[model samples]
Target: MNFKGKSLSLKEYNDLADILQNKYGMQFLGDYEALCSNIAAGKEEEKNQAKPEPVIKQGQGDEEKAVFIRGTIRSGQLIRSEGNIVVLGDVNPGAYLEAAGSITVMGKMRGTGHAGTQGDYSTYIAAFRLEPMQLRIGDIVTRPPDGKQYKSKVPEMAFVKKGMIIVEPYLGKR
Candidate 1:
């Protein structure tokens, strides 16, 4: 792309191309000048479109907040929350879930989940079927045993134990 007649470097061009393709659904067709013009046109169209106002509930703060997802997390999708995350459906492979406090899945969890991402190892991950592709707690990262599919009828919880992550049966509240 040209900025006041100055051309962009290859890396900068690639980055801008990625933004255009991913954000505006524009495919690069060997015409940099046309791509830039299309981007400008898209921005103008967006400016003319009406947008809904966001809602904020009173008395709720970030530390006390938890993100709740009601459906399956598909591949290539990522969900991140600053507090906690609770998913009502399965987390499919290639999906990613990250939270600062804890992560809870009401159904199968076959994706990558990172809880306590801010280094709070006390946080845990619980799921009805804890069969994740990978898991990270605090600074520790681990993957499921090689070649073994998880087949459990009960819920399970994973937490930090002795500087490592350990999985155990999630036998409800005491």
Candidate 2:
């Protein structure tokens, strides 16, 4: 190809490709010889195929079992459930929790939390100390206000209302 208006030799082209691959984890598709070889060997099709979406199994009936977590969910941890999720401990930053139903954390929630993942907007998220980095309920997404968050003495809950996610103080209701 051309570089700085000069025709680049094969070696220079490959060297540039290697640099790009190493620095950015990107494939350089300009190597015709390699492409032809890969295509002939049927490896190109495998590499180009799109990844399949994940399938979530449904419960036997309309009621699904809730998942209960009993310890601190530290950073980098991910939790997912088909039904509701109840965490008896804290969820630290960089962690994630996703559920098709509601999410209830008895302790602090300072990570990413998603509830109603299956398009059920009626689900909600409740936490004793709700200061999550991000929150999602159904298709709506929200984040903490861009300033210091006030710590509430009472637990807080989030739900979708009027196509927007709203946070409100949760009063225990049997």
| TM-score per model over all chains | 0.62, 0.62
Question: For each candidate, what is the lDDT?
Answer: 0.83, 0.82
lDDT of 1 by residue, 1-174 (tens): 323433566577788779989999987655567657767786787788767333222222134558999999999999987778999999999999988878999999999999987778888999999999999998899988887686757899999999999998889655
Residue-level lDDT of model 2, residues 51-82, one tens digit each, is 63445444311134578999999999999887
Clashes of 1: 0
lDDT of 2 at 137: 89
Whole-structure CA lDDT of model 1: 0.83
Which window of 10 residues has the lowest lDDT sum in candidate 2?
Answer: 54-63
